[model samples]
Target: MILATCVAPLAAFACRFNVRDVGFVDLGSDPYRLYLYVGDSMPMAERESLQSISTATFYDSNVKPQLLPLAQARQSEARAFIPEDFTGGVPAAVLVSPDRKTTLSLPLAKSGVSVLQTAWEALEPIVDSPRRNAILEQVFDSYGVVMIVEGKDVAANTKVRSMVDAAVSETTSKLPGLEKEIQQPPVVAVISTEEMEAERAFLWSLGIREVKEAPRVAILYARGRMIGPVLDGERLNRESISAILDTIGLNCECGLDRKWMQGVMVPLKWDRDRKQQVAKQLGFNPESPEIRIEMSQILAKSGAGQGIHRSKIIGDTLDELLTGYRTKGLAPENPPKQNKKPFAESLEMNKPEASELMLSWVVVAGILILIAGGAIVLFARRRES
Candidate 1:
């Protein structure tokens, strides 16, 4: 596979995606938090000298300054997480909301002391994460298997935690090949139930009460029965986790429905979001079929569009869009409207795509012709001599 390179990094960039290890934690209860760190270790004086007075560590950790490893120091460039243009030097921190949006960036201080705590407090009130929380919950719902660990017993659950992490890494690494075998990527949620005080009652309802011997283990699979793990009597181990992973969410047929791929669900949803954004921009009812159809066609023209095009659903929406655009006077100069649907739908589904055999035959035929020409010349020369 060929990778796209940055031809002119310093000059300009069409796009860039950073796939490094991004430091993330269960948002727990907070809508937003500050992630502060230096690229290299710094003395207390140097840390204190910085403008922001914030601690990057957890609740009970001691306050000291040091550089982080490649994994911990890695930052997210994912959508909503990327900060606006900031040429801030290293050791700078970013304030991220629950949805991974970078709300504020703390550039290194030139002079006077600027505590990170003050910025944290100031940004806390303004940050909100209702939408992000809902989306996260939806992902948890979709996962065929998920391991939930409590915040307090993380250290004790180290062995199992490592197992869970390994499973996740392996599943993700093999996800592309496993699409036909699995409904979704294997996922695990290492959450802080105590930090999420409100969810405690809900956990109890699901029979996962926090007792003294709380193993702090739970497996979630069924959307209908989102049950709590019975840490005591219930068997919670590597075998059980593996069983859950192997059994559920299989595609059954071992065939791909590219026209209706499960992977396109999120991007298809994004198309709706794009439609809504365009409608809001143009003052139209995005929810209306007419307006929605037009926005989808426009969305299919972008990066998100490329994925949407594969499902055939977006491709099917073309005629509707042309009609909608024409009706709204957006398709100027007497736009031609065809009542027929896209031609791709009419093609035979079972027919295999044509291979490169024809090209090979053409090359062979060319060689044969050249050989015959050489032979004719040789025969003529011998006869004449």
Candidate 2:
């Protein structure tokens, strides 16, 4: 029994294949699998090809070269492969193994097309020939395959449909070579919509209009005059409202308001402490008219109505107090410090320079000279004898 167990272990080891043992074939000329290596300094064609894919596509660093060996070992693995062609000016490298495993590495190239093309070329030999029937059969065993699409704006572009279709056609066409190994076409997964919009907005804000689709999220607010839902003239759901607030570093709480039944109006400013206080004071409906009159009276008595208009004083003080309460719950326990500098100190700081004082005296002397000359001329005329 022990010898049998040892033999079984040996058999499993023999069946396993290393990625290095696989061979790569250049099918770059193939119309369906046209491959290109895009680098930071690659050609334009490769970049364009990559752009043809969806704007939502993104590269997965963890799975890039790791999946190449599996692709070469079985034809079914082709379903997991994606074709990328680089057209940028950046340089890149494509490596493949004899067992059909392929590795496409882009050191500095950001183009997704270059990476895909490199991978396609590396596995072209096994995918194109009939001698690799066993591998193809294995690829066909599954109903759906995983394909990676990489690009910066991959999620926003509508062109991804064509790229996906092309990849599916090319991969499925070779299924006949390994009929028993192949199962189904591959499924394409792109970047999430939220991520796409975020990227778009960021790029646009930075003056990058050429960027991909802009993400959009619905915004909704409570139904009231103070706060309601409206985004570019559209209404939003409760969930959307919450999401919008969250994005802008705000929050909302839902509850009944006895003071102002007009449906909880979110103050212009968010005040957690004030909100709680108001919530507790249910049924205590403070009249707006009364509040206004009280505020007017306070202003009239304070003698702060000289150059500072009465209305301005009332508005500023009320707003300050109300906003403070809403945002930070009541005033501080300790009063604020008043400016108490002595008049002498103030005069010393405000004293004019000697040059400025001399200039002022000269202007005064010129005005006096003109006045005296006019008086003298009038007296002479009167004594014209």
Task: Please give the CA lDDT of all the candidate structures.
Answer: 0.36, 0.29
Write model 1 residue lDDT over 16-92, tens digit each, in one string: 10000000011122333445544344555655644233332322211122223223454433223323442233445
Residue 135 CA displacement from its true place in model 1, Å:
7.5
- Global fold similarity of model 1 (TM-score): 0.28
Off by over 4 Å in 2: 1-209, 212-340, 353-355
Q: Mind sharing the TM-score for model 2? A: 0.16
Candidate 2 on 1-385: residue-level lDDT in tens? 4335433532331211110001000111111111223334434564555544311121210012222222232344433333354333443333322223433332423356545455444333212323122222222232222222123455423444454445445444544432122234333333344333323322221122232243222111121111112211122222222222221111000111111112121111113443344323322212235433432332234312211011111122323323333342221122335547898897887686675577667656666776689899999999996
Pick the lDDT winner: 1
Deviation in angstroms for 87 in model 1? Answer: 66
